[model samples]
Target: MADPMIALATGLSAVLLFLLMIGLTVYLLWKRRQDMRRDNQLISTNSVIPPCTPVLQTLQASSYGSAEVPFFLPPSFKSSTHSAMPEGREEEEQWKQHPHLHIQRGSLTIGSWFPLGSLRPDLYQLPEEPSEWAQPSGSTVRLCFAVQYQQEQEQLVVSLLQAANLPAQCQSSATLVKLQLLPSEDRHHRQAKAQSKGCQPQFNDTFVFQVSNNSVDQCTLRMSLYSVDRLKKHHLVGHVLLPLRQDELQEAAGKVLWRDLETDSDLPLSKHGNIQVSLNYNQSLQRLTVVVLRARGLQCPSNAGVSVQVSLQIHTQVVKTKCTPETRGSTPTFNEKLTFRLLPVQLDAACICLEVQQVGHEELAEVPSTRATAPVSLGLVVIGPFMYARGRELEHWNEMISKSQELVKQWHGLGAANNIYNNNQT
Candidate 1:
């Protein structure tokens, strides 16, 4: 009995010791867990997160005050959820993910809330029906830009002159050349007898150029100003280079000749002035130049000897010029008439040129210009060759001639010549 009791006590003591050790370990673990939780809370509190969809929702929630919307939201604040992992952890995660996602923002200026995909309707509109049209916000273009020159501390209006002359047509057609100018101070505004210029304050510049667009194309114009003051003595101002297009030149060539076709059929050919055209063959001269004439009515001539004094003058330029000048400047211009003649159904390209300037002229020397001719059918070419010009109307030409015969003869002084060159100018 004594031995059993001793053993039981030992066992009970051992069991109690084990329970104490277990309890201490549990308490320590609980305290450690609490500390860890506190550390996590501290880290989360210091971290920041960008707003996402919720921000937009808040923005649209109501028409709140400007302060309600965080004005400094990063442009990349596209996330929809918030995360708090300490700033360091957050930065590490972001760096590991979107290294290229640049964080940008708009200015402090408060603008209207525009949806992401909103677009302007006027962006798409028919050219003829312009989205908007206004005859220059101002009537005068010259008033907008003025030159203020400094000369003896006094403002002087400067004048520019053409260093060299241009083609006759170009001269009259208001073309400008872009070149340096040695200022001419002698030029002063001629005093107006009447108050036509109006009582406007002097501006710094005399002319202003603006680019305008129309349905078909765009154009730039330089306008004169009423008054201007120069802050500096004649300064080397900007140059003016005119815009001359090859297509425009070709079109003008056609129209200039077309205008001369209005002569009365009954009128004597002698009454018309001779047409003079000087052609220049560039290095890449084409084998032929084509002149297409429409023949409606005319008396066909069977005889080939009929002479229609059409003169073609061509020239080889000493200095080559580009199709379009490098600079865009406008030149002064006037109007002049270009006279040329053509016989019905006759396709002729002449090589002719006149030496301009001094007496060392080169008009008499001309190389023949080549032409590609279309073979007319023998049947048509031979039919009543004398009755009318080839590929032209016989009855109409005769009528025109018959109708003007009286005036034609009156002008011709050959009593019977009136049968040819007489018609109403209108």
Candidate 2:
């Protein structure tokens, strides 16, 4: 009984000792965890904190009392942050003042909602239906040349002195000057030799055009400038038209005269000239005879020849085309006859289109083919019944139809070729 009591007491004491040890360990661990948490909180509270940065901000009110709003840009701006803020503020103010204006790819545009594409600015707009003689829009041309007429020699001399301030395109090519004397029967005109490629070319070359003393004052001097490349390509730059008045020529003889080059839209229109024609129809032979008498008050280049082209058209399709021999001068006489075969009933539907064209010649034989030097239409005259013709043209056609085999002669005014064709199209 004594041994059992001692053993039991010892076991109970050992169990209590073990429980106390576990309680102390748990307390220590809890205290350590609480201390670490407090230290973290204290350190975080005492440390510095940065202010929040906004992606976008509102600037001061503009003079118009509108809120200026900055564009939403990330804080990591590409440029310096300090500089970006001022630029943004200025831009924001400008945008608020002008809602229609906006910056696009660094350029200030007139519209904000839509982007501009292939649109020309208002500053470069040109007039609609600009006159042929109107000053060209791009860089202008200026020419320097001299004209002299000697009474004793009965000869007119033209000297191509120099050309200044040529268009920039001429820098890659050689320049030449073509000279023609108006109202003179010079079989062939003269052209100066091509000079070195430059914006300013000096050509002291002189050309002679024979003119009688009686008609010297009635003559005019025409000068045309051209650019020719090494590949034999030709480009007409501009023209200088100078009338040879006796007094002006005498005062300015051999002295270089500077003139601004004018546009080359000098094709002779209907208002610029007139043409006479005679028509006769033979009912028995089923043929139409048209005689081109002559043309007067025409305007053409000096180095060009004039001819009349007659086209017989049934609706939009042309049946036949005939042209007279090319003649020189503003007033030329053709007196050539062109005949077309057709039934009498066909005359009601058939129309005739006459076009006076100027054929230009290039004196330089080396440079052969280019559409730039092709024949230019000077004027157009159409003759037919009713819808195909008007006024004098209609009367002429009616007269010919009424009196078969009887010649009906009339004068017709010239007009633009496109205008005449469009008016007569089916």
Candidate 3:
């Protein structure tokens, strides 16, 4: 009974002490949490802030429209203050504007864009057919021909045709017919005889060709009509081209197709003239020697002399020489030799052109007739780069190259001036 007061005071003192200690501990924890929250808010705010450097800002603005803030911020920072931040809200709006900036949940795609692989059809739906044909498959066909022509301007056309002076002519008789196969390495050709001069000449002929199924796509039958001359030089009159179509081949075993002939639009009518030349290359002397021997059938008017102007060309270099004029009504023999200094390698692109011209001389008062004026071109001949010429020109080139240092003489036909000059100029 005497210690009850003392015990009550002691219990009250212990309870007060325990309460104070708990209050202090709670206050300290609350302050620490507030500091941590402030620190986290600062970090989150700073993370969204753009850099101060102009270069960085320019790069960011160019690519992303603004500074890029990562979406995967710390969980504590995000749950507390992310939504409350103005920077964060602005970043969210930017990401919404450019949806490509967000991490999509499923398949990612550009706007309205699809992969090319998805456009391919299923392999099972493809058609079944051989892409290439088998080899050594072919057929044979026989073709027959008949020709008839009408003469216009009558005897004048015949005289022009006989002269071979004009570029165009109309004649029926003295025609020779030939058949040729196209795209064949052998250049298979056949011919029929000439008919007598008449208003209407008729020809009945036949030809056979070995055709292949694989080759029919590229094969063509060419029939040409020519006017034969006394010099054996055949002038092209007209021609016709027939492509071996599949329908034609199916019914062409013994077909006789009569088709009208048309003028050969591609053939260039050549004037009657010729130039003879000799070429010799001397390795020891480092020189190429060319001899202008003679010119025949030149178109020279009366009282005019014919002369030749020879030009040698290599790359862009040109060397010119001339021959003395010969009297009219005589076969002009130039016998003029022109020499060019060139190395063996330079001969690869070397060529020569001869121009036949008519020169006129007029005697003046007390002046000798040696003064010549007004030269007119009759025809031209070009013997060239050797590699590009065919037939006689190629044969002559081969002969000259095979027998170097020795002269090789050959006669080359001359055509219109435009033919050779235009080609070589380019």
Please give each candidate's TM-score.
0.17, 0.34, 0.32
The digit string of per-residue lDDT tens for model 3 on 1-426 reads: 869999999999999999999999999999999999988976675434333211112122235466754342211123233466676564554446545423341122222233323442454486767632111122211123422111221110000011111122334336666777665578657776533444334454444455655555455566776776666778876565554545434454332343334442322333657777778788778887777766666666555687777777776567555455454555665655677786778767776767787766343244334433545567777676654467676777667777784567667777766323334546
Q: Which residue runs of candidate 3 sit more than 4 Å off their true CA positions?
A: 1-270, 325-327, 361-372, 386-388, 418-426
Clashes of 2: 2
lDDT of 1: 0.26
Which candidate has the top score in TM-score?
A: 2
Comparing candidate 1 with candidate 3, which one achieves the higher TM-score? 3
lDDT of model 1, residue 351: 25
Q: Tens digits of per-residue lDDT for model 2 on 323-369?
A: 98887655676666789997888887888899887766444355346
Best by lDDT: 2
Report how far residue 39 has shifted in candidate 1, in Å: 20
Q: What is the lDDT for 150 in model 3?
A: 18
Q: Which 10-residue window of candidate 1 scores lowest in summed lDDT?
A: 406-415
Quote the positional error of residue 330 for candidate 3 in Å.
Answer: 3.2
